[model samples]
Target chain A: MTSSAAATIALTDVAARRGNTTIWDQGSFDIPQPSITAVIGPNGSGKSTLLHLLLGLLEPYSGTVEVFGSEPREASEQLGFVPQSYHVPGSDYLTVLEYVRLGKIGNQFFWRSPKGMDQQVADAIEAVGLAGYERRRLRHLSGGEQQRAAIAQSLMNQPKTLLMDEPFASLDVRHQQRLAELIHGLRMDHSIGSLVVVHDLNPILPYLDGVIYLLDGHAHYAPTSEAVDEDLLTHLYGCPVQVTRTAQGDIFTRVTGHAP
Target chain B: MIELPTVTVQENWLEILTADFMRQAFIGGIITAVAAGAIGYFVILRQQAFASHALAHIGFPGATAAILLGIPITLGMVTFTVVGAIAMALTGNRLNDRDIATGTILAFATGLGLLFSNIASTAAANVQNVLFGNLLATTTSQLISFAVFLFLICLTIAICYRPLLFTSISPEVARARGLHTGRLNLIFLVTLALTITMAVQVVGVLLVFALIVTPPATALLLTARSLPALFLSIGIGTFAVIGGLVLSALFNLPPTFFIVSITTLLWVIATITRPQNA
Candidate 1:
């Protein structure tokens, strides 16, 4: 089922609680399509929760969630996800080529290697610059390469909206740069929108088109080029944190004044 | 099965085949071989080799209780082990996290088995076959039951193949795709329970672990893919079963021990020398 319709993720009056503590309450947000949106928040400030709700992973206590204007499962053909966890243990024997092939399974474009799977696999690997490593086992790949393979797997079907959680969690500068480039290319070349849930927002600033500032069960929006000053940073982080733009051409996080 | 392996190795070999006891042994080995290999694939994938062994051992007490009750032991063993497997799957991601829970379940089941066994006055050697396995007693009826187990396993795996594989490998990914993960896990557990129950008579408890783990472990060295490894593991298991059964028959050795030994030896050698990628 090819859906040409606009793909938007919206949550309304969503609240979640574990035991008695309310993690999020009456939070509402609408993410735009054809754009790269960054979801940034402190550890317990409902970052992953927001992503989960959007992806329909966790049903909200009281709200409606729609992806591509349909239920998450209903529109799964238009969505793809790269989760935060590492590759599953005991499944380390899968080759990079076969591992990535899983991304294509649910869709109509799935390839069991007969018709046109090779090109798709090659393109995905080259897009991530993991060209020579398809034959390597998933366990043997470096953390960054494995991340790329994960991305390759997620993109095997060329999803309309790709959801990634901490995609650059533990990568070196080179890998982070490569991933940033690929994310940029996905937006430009494939026109595939992306929502990235991240703790450290500075590394992803370059490729982002918008920001979903979440704080204590609430979310606000800002364009990527806007000045995310100390006030905005502190409010989003739920702590006093200074945002500095350095001449080395990068942003830095620093401790600011004590809260009043 | 194969003309009784008319061999010159042992004077007892030809004579034993004539005994109803030898016929049961051969049929029993064949039954457990197919049953173990089929359920073992998921056991290997769920990384539940240890957990499955623990599940099989759980039957000891139930079997003992049945022995004391004078009821058929197979039904008693299946009922308890299936419950054990289901309980483990239902609890929090028992497949992941710490081994403390598996350790607890193992101790509890073994304790129950001991309790029942201690109460039994007859304490027939047949209980040992149920606990460890006794291919020497595999009768025609048991062989039919095993064939049914094999058919059930094939049907279950066939119907739910993709979802099962998806959950087994990348559960988070499968969940993101909105697959029914919890139900699929239950299906896998049910399949595993069938293996333990069917093989309990032929290979016993200790060797059941070896049956479920060894072929897959060795196949892991040769294939980095899931389907291929599954077929390859079953293939390796069939060979192991045949070799062990024949060797035991020819030389008058315990079939379970012989099969497990050969399988373990090969797995260890493969682990040492096979390409490290897998």
Candidate 2:
């Protein structure tokens, strides 16, 4: 694990509320650079809310949140966000290539078109393993392919810190593995610190370096090895959980009183 | 000064182009079509179709109010719709409750239009022209205003194209990327209000919605790329205007019926031959 001195995202005494309900209070955590941190929580445990706080889309009711030791809003250039529910528009007039070009809109001026924008877009798409799919409209792509295009859009910005909300949801096993490998490669090569929200932890288990378990509006920070244990998960879930290691290096967990 | 072309009178469709009023209407229609088609792409992209429809209806009261106050109808329409656009922008930012806010604003605007039209007895008698339009009666000054508004629409699109697309496609990511979405939204609303006001003269209050929505939507079926779709939308709009005007001149029918009919017909053709199940 990287030292806390290399933290890319740091939150201290941060409090946030959505409408009448409080999401998190006095939430503090530091996400180290060049690492993968899996954020796991139940339905109402403020997983999505934390991403909003980091992105400055929602203001914290109190305390401070920082990205790269600066305010999140100030450091927006270095940050990338992949929302959980991104779909191609029904009247999709945008090709995948054009959609990804919008990624650089933030960093560039309205006038003075940047040089080699096409090459940059191509490289980003290729990095996400979507090279030939550039000309296709988003509506023509499959769900997994659409997700890849979304990732390519984010990757085009070359962000130092990537925040993915439910990156593995609804993905088949092969696509999920492909995404995991791609993300792992990004972390290794670019040294990008990524915080991924996941409902099922098995797909990302092999790639995770750290874990943040959110329970009752507060985060329980732990290393991957310590956080994935049966006892810790059982207590956190407020129910019996059976965790067993399989031959294929997978730690499968079954919550008791739930179907197999 | 440029020499104006003199045409030989003939019993053909081109004969209608000889009349000065017909020429003015044609120019006004072309200008209005280009503006509506260009701006309509963003409207469909952002899913603000209902809000845009509401904005058009909001101009009705402005027209009636202008007639009652003895001011230029275009001036009142611009003032009222701009104000209505601002109100909608403020109240419609909340995702879940925007439809309600838009509905309330639309109903209120319609009510004010009826009340103001009734108060101005002379204008009330000509209210059909305000609601259904009289394209052949367009004046030079009205055409100039359309030109100015069209220029402004183009300028805004040129400056805000990238960020606007970013915001429309993904508001949260755009915000995270440090875009001033609120400011962009306001600028778009103002531009839309101005464009809608210009459109009202050619197509009237009730029928302007067709031009703003149909062309761009039809273009969506033709192309999967934005630039092509934009150009196609403008092309379709221009064609519909020209076609509708010629047909109206020939059949002695209301231009609104022809304009809306041709636009909807183009959309139908597009839908039938669409590449995907759009």
Using DockQ, give the best candidate's number: 2
Best-fitting candidate, scored by TM-score: 2
Report lDDT per candidate.
Answer: 0.74, 0.82
Q: Which residue pairs collide in model 1, if any?
A: B24-B138, B25-B135, B61-B113, B131-B205, B132-B203, B132-B204, B132-B205, B133-B203, B133-B204
Interface RMSD, prediction 1? 3.6
lDDT of 1 by residue, B134-223 (tens): 777666766776778778888887777666666766677777777778877777887788788776776787567777877877887887
lDDT, candidate 2, A86-159, per-residue tens: 66363255788888888876434466667887888998898888889888888778898888777778876778
Would candidate 1 be rated incorrect, acceptable, medium or high by CAPRI criteria?
acceptable
> First chain TM-score in every candidate?
0.85, 0.90
Worst 10 residues of 2 chain A by lDDT: A85-94
User: Where does candidate 1 stray beyond 4 Å?
Assistant: A1-5, A18-20, A106-119, A238-240, A244-260, B1-9, B15-24, B94-99
DockQ of 2: 0.46
lDDT tens string, model 1, A1-260?
A: 34434456776776765566677776666666778888887787777776677667777777777787887667666677888884777447777877777666632222244468778888888877788888788889888888888888888877888888888888887778777788888889888888898777766777778887666666666777653667778876667888777899777676666765
